[model samples]
Target: MLDPILKRIASSPVLIYILRCCIGFLIGYKLYITYPDFELFWTLLSIILVISPEEKDTRRLSIERFKSNFIGSAVAMVMLLFLEPNVYTIIAGIFVTIIVCRLFNVLNMARVALVALLIIMVQPHQTGFVEAPIYRFGSVAVGCIIGLLIVVLTSIIFRPLKRKFGIPY
Candidate 1:
C-alpha cells in the first residue's frame, strides 16, 4: 500500500508543477539577492515562464520571443536618443518601439529591447546614453541566458510527452 502511494505521488502532474515552481522561485530568488534589482529578476522569471521547452507549442513561441527582444531593443535605443526620460516620454517610446518593431518585422527583439531601455531610461541616475545601452543589452543577455538554462533543465528533468523532440544543444 505504501509503495503504491509513493508511486502515485511520484507520477503526479501536481508534483511536476510544484517542482518547476520551486526551481523557478529559487533561481529568481538567487538572481534577486545577487543583483538586488527587481527588474532583472522579474525579467528572468518572465522569460522562463514564456519560453518553457516542455510545451508542445514552443517552437513558434521561442522564435517570437527572440524576434521581439531583438526588434524592441533596437527601436528603444533609437527612440531614446530623441526623448527625455519622463513618464510621457517613456510611454511614447514604448508605443513607438512596438510600432517600429512591427513595421520592421523584428518585433520580438524590439519588445525585449524596449523593456530594457525603459528600465535604464526611467532610473533616477544620470547614467549616460552609452552606459544605458550597455546596461540594457546586458539585462537582455542575462534574461536570455537564464531563460535558456530553465528550458534545458526542465526539458531534461520532465521529459515532455512529445512525439518527436530534439534539441541540438
Candidate 2:
C-alpha cells in the first residue's frame, strides 16, 4: 500500500533531505506566524538545524542541539539576572557558553548554543526585563522539542516501511 511510496521516497538521500527541509520550513513558518510575539526565528533556525538527510543523524543532532540550547539558555538567564543586557554582557555570555560547551563535549555544536545565547541575551527589550529571557528560553525549548518529535515520529512511521521494502537502514 503506502509502504511502496514511502520506500521509494526514502531510497533517495536528496529526496529525503528535500522532504525534511520542506516539512521543517512549513512547521517553522506556522509557528512563526502563530506566535507573533516570540523570537521565533530562533525556533525556525533550530528546526532547520535539527533536520538531516538520515534519520540517525537527525536524532543525534536534535539531542545535541537540545542540550546545547539548554546550556546557552541557562547561562543567559543567569547572566541576565545579575547584569544588564549590554554588548559586553553578550560577549561574556558567548565566552561562557563556549567554555561550557567545550566542557560538555559539545564544542562541535557550539555555534548553535551561541545562537541560543544571543537570542536570549541580546533582545530589544520589547517585553519586561524578566519576562524576555523566559519567553526566549521557552521558544528555544519549543523548537528543540518539536524538532525531536518530528524525528522520532518520522522514524516510527518510516522504519518498518523501509525494513519491509529491503531498504538500508
The most accurate candidate by lDDT is 2
TM-score of each: 0.56, 0.84
Runs of candidate 2 exceeding 4 Å displacement: 1-4, 53-56
Worst 10 residues of 2 by lDDT: 49-58
The local distance difference test score of each candidate is: 0.56, 0.79
Tens digit per residue, CA lDDT, model 2, 53-161: 6555766776787788878887898889889889899999999999999999888889888888887887575688988787777777777777767777776766777
Q: Write candidate 1's Cα lDDT for 98-120 as tens digits.
A: 78667867564565656655655
lDDT of 2 at 64: 81
lDDT of 1: 0.56
Local lDDT at 96 for model 2:
96
Error of 1 at 128 (Å): 5.9
Backbone clash count, each prediction separately: 17, 0
Backbone-clash count (model 2)? 0
